[model samples]
Target: MRPVSVRYDNSSVRVCMKKKAMCKIGLAVMLLLTPMMGWSAKRLNIVIIVGDDWGGPYASAYTGIYGRNLPSNVVKTPNVDRIAQNGVLFKNAYVNAPSCTPSRSSIFTGRYFFNTGGGAVLGGTWDFTIPSFPLLLLDAGYHIGLTSKGWSPGTPRNAPFGGTAHYYQYFGTSVSSFSKSVTKWTAKGMPFEKAKQTMLDQVRGNFEAFLADRKPDQPFFYWFGPTNTHRTWVKGSGKALWGIEPDSLKDQLPVYLPNNPEVREDMADYLGEIQALDAYIGVLLKKLEEIGELDNTIIVATGDNGPGGFPRGKWNLYDFGVATPLVVWYPHSTGGRVVTDFTTLMDLAPTFLEVAGVAIPPKTDGRSLLNILTSPLSGQVDPQRTFAITGEERHNAKARDDSLPYPARALRTARYLYIRNFAPDRWPMGCPYVAAHVPYVFHDIGEPSPTYDWIITNRSIPSAADYFTWAFAKRPAEELYDAHKDPGQINNVADDPMYADIKKSLAEKLLAELKKAGDPRVIGDGGTFDRPPYTDLKTVACQDTIPLNWAPGSHH
Candidate 1:
């Protein structure tokens, strides 16, 4: 297999795109006037703001109009929703995988999670063979920079996101631990509002510094990733900071989650973190506006994935786990349009390249969305944009006894959601216990929170029992759900005779697609990912090279 086309998915694309950009672009830089009315920037800038564990339906942009009864209506995301109002809001956007490393891997390489080899799982290293789009953009003479968490849980040897060359984080990244840091600040008699802003100022300061360092008329690509929306948020922060009452989410929760106070309050705190993320987004938006570059830049905002430490979220293949809120505000594009096209976060790579006039590298799976964004019409602009293929291999490597991955792939279509769990006997989430108490006993769901702890200790309670099984129990070999009928994805119809035909069709489609993508799981022995460096959970990444026997990109 010789790791087919490692160039485009990793560092090679950097070399190739740089040549293309150099040939096409002139050496001279053009200056934009400072004033808003007369600002004359030469090229479009790219700004991608990623939220940690943020989901699609959380924004008011999505829930404000529809899903009005949903829990997201408890909080308002004016800044994030503003991007929707000013541009196109994606109705369905998913990550290739749920875990942070793998999802970010897919987004970076514009390929399926499996194609990234060791990059396909958490605690996995960067497959240097995979080309990062941001690196390509940087190579093509785009002034690029990154702030906050870019790629995580693994050290990218090739410095996938430019290895701190364009990195700018002078103030601090304390905003990631939003509640904890804010608590520390406020505990010292700092005002709550000031304490919160004290953390958010890091976001503002770092972005401004990146902007300041950029050359005039140099089309820039900046990534702002904040993990505040992740777990370990302040319990009462929802009500105290954002005025969201936990009881307000009483009846709005999905059927998978208990509507009890402890659960509601925990979720409310998560929402508060989302609100905090929205505020940071507001800071970025304001900075762009101040520089008269708000409309000049192609602003894309989304989370790496959905919520963590929640039922059927993050580590699961469910929609809440994979689906991300995609809002793109292009300067000359139509606004207020909800595009229902099935798009993955991977698509942003090609979209950025196409807009920047940089040639997209070969062997990339992402299709450019420039056409859809530039179009005035909405809803299914591309008929070929029908479905998304999402899956997960491993979260915490030692999740299972042998460090085996719970390999699963899914085909999410317009009306149906079908999944095939290859390792059905193993826990889809991490194991109930681990070799050591590193990521806690329940490694995957180890983040300490009310809902997580409560579910663990009170799994036998009648009110919490069903959710426990729904969230943690090992899944069957196949699972099918009627998305139209059960939006929460609670009902599994894979075994139901009524859905027999549907299940068969979906399973076949998923397998064929995985095979075409050269997924190691569906090809040959399907044991490549099951072995080391992916299963080498002891280190942040594997030190040894992927042996020849563990061919990653083998194809038919």
Candidate 2:
């Protein structure tokens, strides 16, 4: 299929309204022409399948094939592949933030991370003032339910007076209880394949329960967050339990990581988790088809952020870190296409609202993708989607002086990526040493993993020191990468005089957008973000070296 050419101008609003008006007029004309048509507007069902820490390339549909010999193939996502084949696949989708909490917050609220205040930082409280699409859909009479993870890792501090309980009530029911009950069904004595199937069945069972309990005539919005790909996986289970060979995955390792047996083993395990998630998705799709709601439902499959536990991937602003896989299957609308326009996950919130015929809130920073989704053509349906911006604040504040966030923002265009680090002196990852009386330790990586341990142990070795630097070293204030020439983003071209013009242009564009969005960093109130009280007090440690007067306990 040829790539579709689209031109996006300032008249997007007018275009959208005109299209909507025409649709309404067409409906009215049809009714006037024939009363026997019996066409009634029906609410659409929404199902968002979000994977935790899953990268774009892991899905076979995105990478073009599913096999052990294929490069970058550690897992086969046939179910996810089906969604992309049957719907519109976004080739260039990025998260607002690389970390889970902040990224998910932006996705739910349709706002930028910095605009979310305390919610911008990891494990920080969510400001309830910002609207969530689910709540809006619920208010609009759509049955809403969430399984596994939701707006999580941090507490919703302002969720009415009842706190977390009230928050769950807003979603109708929390499926965590059901999830726990199903976990018991995975008996220890069961065979590996049977046990894995049982676990996947549990997830599907939760979704079935939600469907069974919903009002028959009312449409529904379901948020399905699977935790399969998260860290602390069953080590070597891919080989011992899942029958996946580590050798088969060696060639599939990410370019940023060393192509060794240990890394390949880790990748295989991760792929195992991804395959499990994909199987569960197949179950959900089958259920939707059986219930006769498949065609009426809007199914969206995506990831919160990039791969976790890998170097310069998760928790970093590199392309692999922030890029996500987005597949949208809106029945009776658009299908069998691919969109190359730059897209942010935040757009999903506005897209959902627009599709539901609900007004998008004024504070939303993301534009609706409804125009692109409904359009028959693919590729660049929205010409204005030429860039994607992502930022990062504090993430995993466990290392010494971790309260001092490594603040950074980045702008990604079709050919280049520009980043501006607010605090260049601090380590991009956590400080090498902890506050406690212990040897060199790094805690900012979020979870404990063999990949991280290998990097830390070999930091002093001449052969592996560069990898360590790439993973945890302090970065310069400005960084630029030629995306076309270096998709891996291994080279820093910011200091190259030849590319100064491009760098300056991207930097200015990013700053202008940030300022327009009322970002705290550009508006001169950025200090407030750094001063927000940490949700987990234990992660706080004194940062005496910071130039700012902010201290751990003193911020309060």
Candidate 3:
């Protein structure tokens, strides 16, 4: 084509004018695209789903061995499995503490359980004031909404952030508050309908509503912590409700029972709850997809602690207790990848902030795994990030044999697990074993069932003793296990002659991490817990094991 030669007058001027026009166009394009890129990097919609008192075996990624090898008996966590399948599934993940409130507090604050100073479960209003993870996200321009249990049974009103997440819904049917709710089912039966209603009516429904209510702000962070599969078992009519049968699930037999029928049934009911929770999670996932946020959203699904009330499950420093499943899904990036790194609950807050392109506060101890998710094949992780440490303060005090307090700390890695018991002689379960007429916590153990009866009747037998004796048994300053060889963590190989070198190395590593994490209970120094008359093991005397037929809300 013949072009018109119109720029012959003032040739230098024309050249300069052309260069200026190109510069202006470049600047305009940059101005427009820069914001879009920044928005993409900064805009993150996060959903964290924490299962109540669950462990790694419940999730399908880790061999799906909750109680047995039966596939039909396993927990059907399709939504949770979806997270693992879509993102990086951390095969070796752990909670900083094995107990409820303490683990959650550590997770939120990115602090060790010892520093939190509240113990395993919250006792009262004074116990609530710990730092929160959501508050930090809120400060970083996130619209935070919590469905069901967020930061705790009690609020962290006194911590630096000082305020709680916008708790849109409280899940489960329990409404006695976090403290009394523990005692609500002191009798033999399941929890009151109020407890179940709270979950069905409020927690699940509220989560759906919360999803529907989002306005697409700068970014949104939602905590969808559920109360599914916690306790007070419910069995649906003929078919099992939650894709599990308690008796059919695998039972680890916590140092107490040797594969008994009664215990199997109880375990089945627990699995039912897990299955039911899984279905609800599926609902949430469907909602996310329906709202067109599924592809861009980051979904983290895991458990708060281990199984409740079993030996070395919920309250102890064993892998069976502190080890949990961590499934992170970033549908837009790496999907269907499995990561074998050992991660911690404390890592959550920092990771959330890091993914959103926000500055991580110096006070936090957790390191972000965003890079790992974004570049799964590169293995991008801090070389220095090694181990996760967890601590415990108390369990159901009213449910112990000797009435002694249990205090412990632990460190875990891909290969090893180390436990340091501060109160070595104390019972992991509460000492006195309260025998109140009302539904007492430990009275459930005193029931006439075969396993319970065997445990109470044969306290003299080492294997048949209650959890108090099992927990109160002799312990070393350090106990280590090679998790690769011993996933169940039954054999105590800390003193084995063959693994002496490994033990020494793990001990040194544990001390270094504890010190780095600001744990005061290093070596024998005993952290700052010098409060006089710390919880006691004073026993309450009673006549016989409480009856199992006690009515709801009645004396045991």
**Candidate with maximal lDDT:** 1
TM-score of each model, in listed order? 0.89, 0.83, 0.75
lDDT of 3: 0.57
What is the Å distance of residue 121 in model 1 from its true position?
0.9
Clash-forming residue pairs, model 1: 9-130, 9-131, 10-130, 10-131
User: lDDT per residue, candidate 1, 385-475, as tens digits?
Assistant: 9999999888876667677788999999989999889989777766655332243335576465567666656666687788878888878
What order do you get sorting by TM-score, best first?
A: 1, 2, 3
**Which has the better lDDT: candidate 1, or candidate 2?**
1
Question: Each candidate: RMSD to true structure?
Answer: 8.5, 8.8, 12.1
Model 3, 1-556: lDDT tens per residue? 1111111111212243467676455445434543443433547788887888767446556553333342233545676777777887775678887766667776776666666655434431323344455655554455667655655554453232234436664344442132234234424365644444444454456766565565444467777666655554443311233334444544443433345655566565555555556655776687778877788778888888877645566666776678787878876776777665667888887787666654454456777777778875523244555677777655443444333345566777767787777665543444323333643334322222233333434456565554434433446666777766765565678789998998888777777877776665663556344332333445545333334443333434
- In Å, residue 113's CA in model 3 sits off its true spot by 2.0
Model 1 alpha-carbon drift over 4 Å, by segment:
1-41, 64-68, 434-440, 537-556
C-alpha lDDT (0 to 100) for residue 212 of candidate 1: 86
Q: Which ten residues in a row have the lowest lDDT in candidate 2?
A: 1-10
Q: Which stretches of candidate 2 lie over 4 Å from their true place?
A: 1-40, 64-72, 157-188, 398-402, 434-440, 534-556
Which 10-residue window of candidate 3 scores lowest in summed lDDT?
1-10
| TM-score pick, better of 1 and 3 | 1
